[model samples]
Target: MKLKVVLRKAYDYVRYDLKEIAFPSSLPDPPHIKKRRKLTWEERYLVLKEASRLYAASWVRDIGPDLRPNDYKKYDDGEEKPNEVNGATKEKEPSTLEDLAIAARGGMETLKPALQRVYMTRASAYRDALKSFIEGYKEGVQQVMEKKENSGTQGEEDSPKKST
Candidate 1:
């Protein structure tokens, strides 16, 4: 009903509904407010790397514990074992995407849930980029091999043999 109340209501509406508030005309820059800036190329790369590690760690955690490598334990008999019941150790589990996730989380002790979500959002795109890079590299290697094979055989055949 009063001007102050009306002004407060308008400010709330702009802050909440519109998700932004115009600075007062008198101040060119708001005091004590941090300016938001876009991440530079290097910063983005580091963020993506961190996010990927966290995301992978989450996946590794989700996979059943059985697939994860267990630490070797020594028994009273002075024998080491991976499984509890027998002294025999299991053959290493085959590596999977889950393994990659575990490796990515290798150094990190804890994951922040909010940051993990951001990483998860970027993970798919990063994965696609990596896949493309791998494919390109493979193609380049294959082409080099093909050229070597062709050139080696052709050069030998084209050369005149010296009679002994």
Candidate 2:
């Protein structure tokens, strides 16, 4: 008797409950897709330029205190000695942006490597994000195209054919 009751309940669940769950009366609406526009070259340049300036400012602010001129001073009986490296006097570390530029010997060559690394890192990250965005956009476009084709075919099948 218990086995019979259990089998009947299982059959009812499979027949009625499973059908409603698998094929609901209504489905939720599809999500709306929005198009994303690419940035213009001038806008991209300005954004990267501003980001570089901010990054440089923060880098300078963090290292400024450590590079103070007084930190390198040598007191020797009222005479200051220059920093010596391998028995030869070495130039003092620059404590300000102006001093650093001057120390660079009048060209941007000294700063190129560090700035290049920063730009490369930023460019790589931007490239990855843009790649992902483009891939998703393509997928969305494909989905929209498939949906349109499917609907068009269904509409034709459902409508009566008119004689020409």
Candidate 3:
């Protein structure tokens, strides 16, 4: 009696599988994915500002701490005199992103190469993180499918038999 029940269930499963294989178009359409909203100008600026600060901090760390602007003294009568610009001194070491930007005086051209390298490194890291996340998601879906199949088989076995 148990063997008959098992055979009947197996046949039913095979028939269902065959039907699905023959009628692939019967499958429902995938869920619609919402489009991501674009970032506003303020949001873009904030993101850029934060990235610049982080990059600056990392660059400062890699290079030594001595990021102070050079101060050359001018001699009028062979006597050394401290260089001054409108009664202001340029002796402060760059300890903040704004200060670093000011100290760079050479403008964007000078920092282009370093910025490109940093961007490439960050992009690679982001790709790796995204790949790992996708792999994990696939594994989770496979596990859920396996669980559903097992539960479905168990339910068939546990249910009371119907009399004709």
Candidate 4:
């Protein structure tokens, strides 16, 4: 009884509600996808740098005053490696749009709407920009490490050693 009455009411509501609205025979084609403007290398670099700094600041802010800038250095210097000294592998931490938005918010109520708007408006582009920046950064670091190791080996060969 009550169940039948509820089902009938729902069906009537949907049927009447749908009839009141006008729908074209064929739905209009979806809006064409626009080509997004490309960012220059410098612009992308800046975006990545700013994003990193903003995220780091947000982390510190979330932790409150007990944590300081120097304390964050450990995170900056440590990279996840399978063969770490203790054989413990480090886990990679991924950041999301919400995390970025919260960091960019800086706890200001007035900024929330603008932050959300920008995030929604440009999230894809921003994500790609960050991706490129991080890839380039990793490549640079690897090259530097290779160079340092090569120099150290060359120095050892060039230096005189006592023979037993």
Candidate 5:
């Protein structure tokens, strides 16, 4: 084989076997890259609050197979119409909350829309409700933390720890 052809084949083989390649130098920082900074105490609280709200709503979404997230709070299970339960007929079809709990556990298949009647309406309502819950829970946690901090400072002044 010609020298050039032999070299080309070897080069092609190496290239094909290589799975990845690295730049000769570091690439530019991504435009969307964010700085690493600790969140302020309040921001941390808000983060926790929001997480809790999302978690709560996600659980609520697990209602019956027919139920959607929107109706999780309002839909009544058909059991109320008179369905046999545990060996006997129960009173209600099962409240929205009950269905959700069951659904979360993999009992139900779907949920009906309770409040999200329309498109924009549902998106807006769900967004607001999640924000509200997050803020409320965050504030509650902050209040408790403040109370504990205050009590601790006062305790130090009023009755400092002493060696036995």
Candidate 6:
């Protein structure tokens, strides 16, 4: 719900910006797919592992851009057999789904009010922006519902959100 609203607001802003754009683009276009620094196997594994952990933690499944920055490790020893020591002596506490869920809920509860205040205190512009965003979202949803009602399919299985 929240991300959908955010994206719709972004789309609205883009359309508004395009309409208000001053000097038009004049530069020549660049290549379609710019090259990026290549990742090693260790980096790839770390990324996949972190994403898996985050997906498990998300109650509403709206984890935004990496809230934590990561560094790349150049090399990694290949996978090891279970219960075998390969010179790494540290042990980590194993967490289950229940533990992760509880932790995620705790994190959200602690962060929600602070996040609200962050928007509220930025400036008058930010305050009004947030209000307008919420109002616009409500109007859009109402219009969608009305259209759905007229179409005769109040499909509970259908939500307007785009799934990745």
Off by over 4 Å in 6: 1-122, 153-164
Question: Which numbered prediction scores highest in lDDT against the true structure?
Answer: 2
State the lDDT of candidate 6 residue by residue for 88-115, as single tens digits: 6656654444444555577987556655
**Candidate structures ordered by TM-score, highest first:** 3, 2, 1, 4, 5, 6
lDDT of 4 at 115: 64
Give the TM-score of each candidate.
0.30, 0.33, 0.36, 0.28, 0.27, 0.20
lDDT of 5: 0.67
Full-model lDDT for every candidate: 0.70, 0.75, 0.72, 0.72, 0.67, 0.68
Candidate 4 collision pairs: none
lDDT tens per residue, model 2, 5-42: 99999999999999999987786556886656899999
Q: Per-residue lDDT for 50-151 in model 4, tens only?
A: 888777777653553334554443333466433245533554554456555665667666467656766776888888999999999999999999999999
What is the Cα-based lDDT of residue 49 in candidate 5?
90
Error of 1 at 61 (Å): 43
Tens-digit lDDT string for candidate 5 (1-164): 99999999889867764433432446778999987898999999999998887667667634343435454344366534222245554344776567556555663343334322344566898999999999999999999999999999998899967889
lDDT by residue (tens digit), candidate 3, 1-164: 69999999889878897777787656555689666799999999999998887678766533323333343433587653543233443466544455446546767875665566657878999999999999999999999999999999999999999999
Show where candidate 5 strays beyond 4 Å.
1-117, 160-164
Top TM-score: which candidate number? 3
Off by over 4 Å in 3: 1-107
